[model samples]
Target: MKKALPATHTSMMRYAVLSISLIITTGPAVSSALPLMAKNFPNISLAMIDMIATVQQFTIMIFLLISGSIAKKIGIKPTISIGLIITGVAGIFPVFSQSFVAIFISRLLLGVGIGLFNSLAITVIDLLFTGNDKAQMLGNRSAMEQLGVCILNLVVGLLLLINWHMAFLIYALAFPIMIFFWRYVPEPRVNKESKETHQKINMPVVWLALLLFFLVMCSTAIIVQIPNIIVRGSLGSATTASLIISLNTLAGMAMGFLFGRIYKVVSDMTLPIGTFLMAMGAILIGMGGNLYIVSLGTILCGFSYPLAGTYAFNLLSKIAPQGSETLGNSVLLIGCNLGSFISPIGVRILAKISGNAFIGMFIVLLVVTGGILVFQWASKHVSKMKKV
Candidate 1:
């Protein structure tokens, strides 16, 4: 006979799931509104208009470097609450002002808020669950994040039709999530003694983070290059490109939702498997002449992104010392953000060297994938030898 869990426990899980979705709300906050914003601010250069998105990403990177330390000092709950409040408040600033500088400031603040809680989502999940449950929750978190991106983008797109400023209102969703978090999510107890006893980060974890960096960099290249690739090839219009990208997002979300089951089947091999898929995707995109093949490549790349991310974070949680999940997540986030920031540059450099951008990107993906496979095999052999 099995004992049933209490209602309170179930309710808390529901609230936690809802609260975690806020972590991804910022993903499409300004992205969907960019065109309308450009029209509204006709005086600003297109590059500067693009800065409205880039500035937030830069802030997110900077804050990600420090968010773990902030959590340690202030406590995760307080840090998350503050982040939610800042995100909610600052995200709406564009509603009040049309000035480029004012909107930039708002986006920067939103980034700060996002950075504060971005890594913390995994940390909190690590605290609340364990073993298979933890894996399941992490998968669900990834799914919810992708779903949030889809929903917010759709909502913002609709709102942009009314007015760009209306899109900012989506950020206000953070307040309720903050309240849910504060009320339902238990604060993890800190052990002052564990601080002194913390172990150095595992070498394997560092290697995994590096691998993730390359993977993210490669995956992001698809997003950056697809528009130009399609336009230049005469394969599709901008709207078609957008639709393909949305399908890619949807594929990732579907994989995320199925991740728990997938993990059971793939287990530790998830990393290599995901890397292989990403490489294949990149190759398809680079070589495919038709729109269908390119769309398929985008979907595979999208699917692999979340699959790899979920497994990597799960591995990090396993390797991290007691009371150091936050720090581990911070390291992972740094790698992810750095990968994204450098992706465009990396592509351009490779394109220049190879004389063909698509081919260059394909080479990069193939090399990275080969490296990851070798690393995985070596690590497994080493482990087996240690057991002997």
Candidate 2:
């Protein structure tokens, strides 16, 4: 029989695996550099230039539904390693080529790399830890992911001052992360019984995934509309809007770090609480006239968005049958990606109908989130009554 690693070693390995979150930074890191890229490729339409950032999202969505199945056959460690390598290579390919077509293709492939292993960060936590440990690890993973995004965005912005190509080097961070993963993370052991148990999907997982989809949809609208909201409200300029958005990211990082402790106190009510916070934030942003109030609203939404997402993932991990954490995560991933993609369009349609985009999104969020919270409360109350 093989000897088990020390608890300390196991914990270190878990953190190392969480570093895979860096792969998600690739797309967002380039977002700040898009104007520079447009100047470089003046011949390309602005829409096409924007596609360079968004094309990755489409590929990520396509692969998220299947990456879990692929991991089942190849094993998680290898799957994640391959993903990092693919992302690193694709991310750098744009540096060597100035062709719009070439860079677009490279970004699309980078999405594939991210899609391959994004959910594994969560799945690995489910595999390695249990109970509060598992919950804490999940929270840590979210925090690490937001931290990666924050750092990469800052790095890319600074690098863009030197040369647009230099910003692409941020993807190189994946190489060291891959090394850490291979050296510290061990393969999970899955028995035949556990494998069989995870193969069948649960109805609750489907419902939760849909809930996540709607939540993400509403949450993302806050990001998409912030600039417009600020300019229209005369709360700030474009620079001020960006700064507020960065603050929102910081708020998310902080909330993710605190999620484990918060979850302990709120237990199953975490999701409802998150929804309520988001609704309050949306209302503030919709109605506020001052910068401070809007910034506070942004922070609240940012905090609640990731908190709800973390709670959903933790719940899914518990309900997942053994080896099926990846599959369950993938389902949730689909919901999240679909919601993100639809948010801008959904908000636009609602705004058209309401004749005020900002207020329209706020109304949508309040109604939807309020309804979900009520449903959750009623469900819990009924369950308790039945137990009595």
Candidate 3:
């Protein structure tokens, strides 16, 4: 049954479904421990060791495109299970490996595993729920990934005390998540390909993907430049930086839990509101050198991302054709990962142009965020005029 308005899910199955997301975002976070890793692997070059954190992105993008076909052939349940098993096993392989090559391969396999299940995580929500229920769950899904990133990042700090390798053990959480998911979440009925076979994806999905790509790029700029903002601005110490990030993630979690209500109240205005808030944050951090002010800006940026992300995915579920939402999501994720991959270069360009990294980046971010609203307003206005 399509869940009605103001929807909520309280079942054990709900948690089981959300568990996969917790581990999905855990991969990129290994970058946080790179300094410690560099110390431990003295024989390996820093650039090569750094690649361990990113090598998965290529495999992940590859698998994201193909997993839809794989799901169509094998069915979603088995595909999800296979992905989970791969994630759990490959995620921890680094714990046993001292060789950079082996750990790099492990990270590659980890990306492959994540790509297999990444779109399906969103697809499963559409398959199992509907309407506000789906919207709410999508919000929670983003929250789950953010939560994983935050918590596991903290855990990685602690685990490094035990062994440099022990930090990799954090991925073991995926095993239990898989077991519960397999036992509780039933296999959803797969939609047979009919129109989806003949239909090329419509232009709106592509535009949305491009929009997502831009938003992700802007979002990555926020993280990339934060340290420079802290050190250059001399806002505070590393401890202060960590706290600021905590505030950011906590705000995101709160916003995500409340997204359903926000959407119900604002309807289509949700996107503009989110983008505005994000731009506001960028402006604050760019201009506000005060420690507390920067922290507030950080929180606002954090809050806006999941708010915008959930809305985008919810719209995708509506606009994408039946049996093809997964592929549409694939394109979106590709744009998303591509944005992250290229963000540093973008940051460098901004730094060179403005002669200041933090303020210059946010200045451009503010302008780009405004462009999103302009484009949205123009599109809606034209659509209304056509109907009239």
Candidate 4:
């Protein structure tokens, strides 16, 4: 029996849906424990140890390709439940296993778990809500993901003080979230025959995916230079890096709450606003002479991230072909993940031209972003003129 698709789901049900976002970024919560992990495994190279933190991204991309297909077979709720289970089991797997390979494999599964549900997280919002409420929920979802990053990172930090193994316990939090989702959220009634007809990729999704790819590629490259700027300028200590990053996450969380209102006012122009702010953020960090300036820049970057990211998801909700929602989102997720992966190389390549790591990347991004902002504003102006 299928539950009726209502215009609105209950508040608790919405939160149950939102709870899953809390674990999306938890893959990196253990990053702070890397030094301790290195001490535990003397034979492992520092670079490999670092992979324990980032190896998730690679596997995320792999699982993203098939995430939709699995959801199709098992249904969304069960698919998400399985992903959460994988995350919980894999997350704590390191606590018991001493072998580096085993821990590394666990990290890989963490990515798999997140990848499986990443698209469905937003798909659920699309199905359960309508119009402004939908937009607001999407924003809340973004906020929730950042909130998870902020809280779990802190929890992991505190846990690290007791035992390096304790850091993995943070992933155990997923089981409760899984239980909440299973209990409160109803399985969306989907038309398998109709949805199955259009499994092929659509052009709109590809274009949006490209837009997100370029956006993330430039933004990530610019953000990556901030720590280097801090270190090179000798404006702050190593701890300052963590503080600035935290502020960045907090800024994104703040934006997620306000995004729905802001979107009502700006509509599609949110992309331009986001890109413009991102460019400004890079400029401030690259050129600013001190710590406070860099902090402001980092905050700007954070604020802009959810603005662009949520907007991408929102647009996809409306434009994604009915049956292939997860696949469309998977493409967008892959774009951003790829952007993060390529950012370092992009920064290194750009830095050579200007002889300053941050500035070189900032210059290109500023021009590109500025040009697009102008084009977008002009197009809107012309459209208004036509209406008048």
The RMSD of every model to the true structure, in order and in angstroms, is 2.5, 3.0, 3.2, 3.5
Off by over 4 Å in 1: 1-15, 25-28, 195-203
Candidate 2 lDDT by residue in tens digits, 179-216: 99988888766667765564656888898888889778
Off by over 4 Å in 2: 1-11, 196-200, 320-323, 353-388
Q: lDDT: which is higher, 1 or 3?
A: 3
Tens-digit lDDT track of model 1 for 1-388: 9787753357675556446664554544567678878998899898888877667777777777688788877888898888888888988888888688878888889889888888888877777677767777788788888778877777787888888889888888888888888877777655787545544466766877787787778777888788887888899899999899888878888888788888988888777678778877887887868999999989999898888888999888667766667777877888887888798887888779987665676676667667767877898999999999
Global lDDT of each candidate: 0.78, 0.82, 0.81, 0.83
Worst 10 residues of 2 by lDDT: 192-201
Worst 10 residues of 1 by lDDT: 20-29
Q: What's model 4's overall lDDT?
A: 0.83
Best by lDDT: 4
Question: Candidate 3: where are CA atoms >4 Å away?
Answer: 1-10, 194-200, 352-388
TM-scores for all candidates? Answer: 0.91, 0.91, 0.91, 0.91
